[model samples]
Target: MCPEPSTSGVSPPVDAVTGIEAETDHENDAFSDYASDVSDTTSTTSSVRAYVYENGRRYHSYRPGQYLLPNDETEQDRLDMTHHVFSLTLNGDLCKTELDNPQSILDIGTGTGIWAMDIGDAYPSAEVIGTDLSPIQSEWVPPNVQFEVDDATLDWTFPENKFDFIHARTLAGAIQDWPDLVGKCYTHCKAGGQVEISEGRANFFCDDDTLDKSSKTWQWLAEFRKLSEPLGFDIAPRLPDILKAAGFEDVQLTQKHVPLGTWPKDPKLREIGRIFRVQFLEMAIEAYSLALFTRFGNWTSEEVQVLLAMVRTELKSNKIHLYTYTYLNDLKRKAESNDSNDHHSPEKRQNTLTSEAGNDDPGDEITNNLSQDSQFLAASTSGEETLPNLKNPLVSTPSKFLTDFQGRRRFLGPSSTWAYSRHVMGLIRKYLGQHQPLEIPLNTDGTAFALEFPSTKQPGTTITMQDLPSRDYAIYLINTVKFHVCQTYHLFEEQSFMQGFSKLYSEGPQPLNAENKLWYVQYFIVMAFGKALLMRGSSEVNPYGSEYISRAMELLPDVNGLYQDPITSVEICCGLSLYLQSVDHRNTAYVYVSEYLQFYRVLHELICCSLVSPFA
Candidate 1:
């Protein structure tokens, strides 16, 4: 059920700097230099056979065992941020109408495949195809989502008039000719279907009034834009006109004026913009690092690295002036296209929108054929009130309580449970949020702490914490201690903790609740200690440093035992040994080891006592 594209005449191409023969020639020279520079380096795109590259060397490059081949976490964060932006865009009325009924979708230049994956998740029934020049996406994808490593510049491989929706986003350096790409989109998009373009101007200069044009940021922006314009790809200043010219009608454009940092007048907006700045800088360092170096002929890696480091520092600082503009244009045919024969009458479409509006959830409008439950959830999370499904996704499920505790103890909580160390650690974090020094007024094993039930519970009837008895209490204590120790080890070292536990916790009906709590607590403690150690250097190590190493060793055996099912205990042991060795480098190493041994011995005794029958 694809929409028919309206047979509207294509709008004129936007040439903001048109007929300026000198400017066009200048652009040509800049592009030539940029291409030459890209080829001279011993990089992935060593041969400048193509006049342009969009994703740079990162497009096809791979490192073994890497599921996400992005340059760094910053780019990864940007990818994550796309979901946030898309959610905002998709919630709008303009997007909702088309998306609700879209049978086919095309995502052009889908990087890291995040956008496409999210769109697939949102519209499960649609045939969604994400096209990129590289095989960067994971092999495992949604049933309706598929990726093809083909250039978008080539005549699309799909049949004409196939897709109900065509989405081109962030093409920047990749899209050499915008008109041809838009024409291809127009050709492939079903009659009356929509084509949306989301693009950001690359200039780094500030749009805010706070920063002066004389700043280094101004130069950076000028140079970046100047360098890119000559490549026949600087679409930043020409986005609006480009879409209209591609035969789109009733075109709607939304410009997002995002600030670089906490410079905005509003506090919340400043925070959001600041986050964008941080993430953008992170991407710059990771993604654009080598690309920028190669693009600028005279620029060296060392120069780029130094400048990037400075830029990162500037980005983090509240003082630096910078900002960038981003835009999203949504255009649809004037009327239902010829392809959609069973078109709803305008009256029916209005009635549908009105009917959907009555449901108190936005999902009804955006998710045309989604199940009632899913629609409710999506609408609720999307923060729009238009319609409601029979079942609300936000409603809480009945808590899974554990009967294994003393004094009617329950395990499940909003974020964690009592049975897992990670959850308990999360509880500790909750405690730490309000309290300084993080010292709870409880007996070391936590058995002696007073249990406070919520008001809904029956008035206290002299319930004893000792109801678990010595054997059960001891076993619980050993498990708790082990959980804490392993989590602690993970904080100091991150690689194998989750991977190790994934094997440990995956197979059996183990104490999942308790294990999860321990993992989180371990992470918190290690992070806190690491920060303290880093702040004080070796001088601070002598005082509380030994505690870290000791905790690592104490947690190792339980972690090893946890791994006994699949992976070798030796692997965990080796990792433990390495951690211990590294921790001991500090003067507090001996003290830490001895204390950790004591903790381990205490846990051992608790477990041994639990195993022995008190009746015997």
Candidate 2:
């Protein structure tokens, strides 16, 4: 929703120069008792008007309806609700920074100026400027904070190297050229200044595998992407890279999974999710997109309204277990000074092209590695070559798996057995199509004999599964290989994997699950392994590593009735590809190449079958 124009023709509180009403002493007192003695220096000669009305909403006359959200009281209320949700998410803190005293702070796209006002109150000594396309800020504000109506995408008028801190949040669809904005920020910020960009991931996720391609929320996102693409806006998962390319250093990305409804077991997350569902999701999905879809995307208002209703209904479903990923990228402007070149210059453009080209192509590298691994496995299985060494060159020899410590052994050993046990239990429950929870009795050896079914027909009737060593070994091998990847690659800790495994295990089985239990488990393993390789700077020579990793990063659909899930196949293929990269780069390949290939081919066929028709 965009800001609305004032219904009244005349300005509310007339200032002689800027036509903006000068805030009164009473309004100032509402914000702070000890107001600053500084007088307002707003230029009376300025020609900017207060508001322009279009499509029944008020827009800033400065930019003249460029922003799509309404700045009316209703939208302001919605913004405040969103603010509450974020405040709860951050534990009532405005930000997670250690900067004790920032002399100058700037909040870009500060809707309603609530955040800016709070920051001003927190740091009374600092000068805080809130810039937005709408002049919807309240007349009563902290003396240290001032609101300005401006377009952030334009070249900033602020003096260079002035601001000590710059913050932008929830401006995902508002800005077009992010790199340009970041560059402008770099130029204007003081050396060592911090810039924080907070935005929610473009897509939603379901931990218990309820959401999928056919889900309403997923379809809504697809529609949103369709609308956003033409506006030069995208929810790219590469903010850190953009920040780095803009010459910001020490860039760090922090992520939090905010549930859509009150379904999480964790109390805090449940509360947050509840607020998000009530305060944001229910209204925001409709409010934020109505104008864009109608005006820009050629969508009929009725069509949009109907779709929004469906989306809202889906958002309210606790059974869905939906969540959105929110990410914060914190960066520091490089301290060293250098000659500033025009970003539009040919020389700068050429330099950018060269730099981009120098970066490894993840897709090409992964494909090459996969091909090589296939050949190597074929040769080894045919007994045409000796086993290849499979040790990471980056780390010291005698891998963590080779160590004989009890703690390590337990974590890398029986813990995998426990994971296997949990995976098998989930599969059994899934196979039986059980929606209600079931207790699986395990033997002392961490093996499950029969599955128990609590009868709904008879109060105490139960069904059980007998001993199945073959099934147990199959699950065990899959889990063992995953654990080996974690240990060998140093990608993820055994404890963390187990924690996730246990959490999923506790969820048991549900109907129409979006993630296959086994596939999802292996997905994380492959993701962690791929991530480890990327962290080791493997993308430069083996870009395919990044490609597989990227695919793994995305949410995977459930296997449903298939023998194997898509992600499991992807993981096995990725594992072999990684092994191939290791061999090509470090001349080390594990002896289990043939076994990995066989498993990968089988999984690949399963994926193909699932894709064709999982129920088949």
Candidate 3:
């Protein structure tokens, strides 16, 4: 929390709706009128526009909404709060010496102009300008931080080569032309300026599954996306390219995934995500309610009121799993560095039994276990009635099965990580001790592993079957992998050289092969499983799990040939006008950044595995 500043004689706090308080205004006639007109075909679009225009106009005058975010004081206050939080979480205070001095700053879509105001306050000598279209910003602000009402789509008004820092947050569905905005940013930014953008992927879902799909909560979201998409804004996928196109060098994009309620695997993040989500719900109700009602039409006052009530109730419920990815994209021109580019040698690569951090080597322990399992499997394979030469099917089955059985066994006295591990080991031991060879295909298939036969096939036909690992062993392996990864991750979370290694790996150069790719991906998956286990015990530790789990996210570029990291290429291809550098990173100071850094490294390795592969 930031120290409360003297509002200095600013009139008793304006009764503006920001966070939870914003809901009360649903009683306003404007919202009612907007809702009633939705079913009216000809008037719907116009009504919404009128409502938006009017709201924008009214907001310029009477600030009557509540700010629900706990950090809802002022934009500047939030900025200071965000920075301090980020510094402590990421250990940025320790790395503060590495950052350049502050000067010119830019706040994109500076709602309330708080972030810029606080930044200006924090760095009294720096010149800060907050840009947004709404005239709802505070009338009186710090002398150094100024607000400008301008559409970011227009060419930036700032001089070329001017700003030293730029920041933007929560402008989902607002900016239509990201390439143009980024280009303008590029044109106006000074040599080493940094720009950041943060956003949430808006989503709506009901906890009870009892809420009607036709209910107001669902309808508003459907219409909100409907109106927003046609206007040229994509809610979920276009962030990274926008930053790259803007000409910010050395762009770094990181994602903060916020879950709606306690259902999230991580408790701390669940709480934080829930808080933001509730705040977002109220803000969305106020900010977009009129637009929704005006666009969709025919919402009776009773229906509208009920929908509002439903949304709030759903937000407080654990069953609702809505979440938004808050992206923190940080970009800056390359600062002069004395460090030489790092290249790995085969000898060094072969010596990786010990981690890069020079820690206690777990390679012997892991390999020993794998070898023991393999030898036992090999012996069993020779005596199998029909199971083929494939690897241990018993050891592999349970883990994959549990992932797919989310609803089936969740209520059973389900064993998690270690229980699953014990099961696997138990089965392995059982198989090794079996006296007689199991039949090829038995009536009950009581054997641990089984094979399927080809019915009426031609000569030389082959049979195949899948193996099931013990649930206990599967759980243990996964959790143990995650634990080691956390240990491995500690080395990179704050260390500059480790970060450098990760950045380099993200750029390219690593082995590429189907087997190796799958191996690394398996390790990554285990890391995530491990995190879920940790989350069951200590909630705060769950964020660390999110960081690891995120590494397993599918990379479109790596999989579909449709994407590439921004830093690798300077220009857009396929005549695409807009470009994005990476995810934005401004308000992300409140998020778990260290875990994300670790996630990026594993993701990079997985990508490299594919990129350098002979098959590709």
| Number of clashing residue pairs, candidate 3 | 53
CA lDDT scores, all candidates in order: 0.43, 0.52, 0.38
State the TM-score for model 3.
Answer: 0.39
lDDT of 3: 0.38
The clash count of every prediction, one per candidate, is 34, 27, 53
Query: What residue runs in model 2 are displaced by over 4 Å at the alpha carbon?
Result: 1-60, 212-215, 339-350, 353-616
What ranking of all candidate models by lDDT puts the best one first? Answer: 2, 1, 3
Measured with C-alpha atoms, the lDDT of residue 443 in candidate 2 is: 27
lDDT tens readout by residue for model 2, 255-340: 65566665565656665665566545435666677788888888887888788777766655454555665566677877776757
| Model 3 worst lDDT run, 10 consecutive residues | 574-583
lDDT of 3 at 190: 67
Candidate 1 lDDT tens digits, 147-209: 765667665668877888988777776766666676677677777788888776555433223
True lDDT of residue 368, candidate 1: 18
| lDDT, candidate 2, at 437 | 50
Regions of model 3 farther than 4 Å from truth: 1-99, 204-220, 296-305, 333-616
TM per model?
A: 0.48, 0.49, 0.39
Best by TM-score: 2
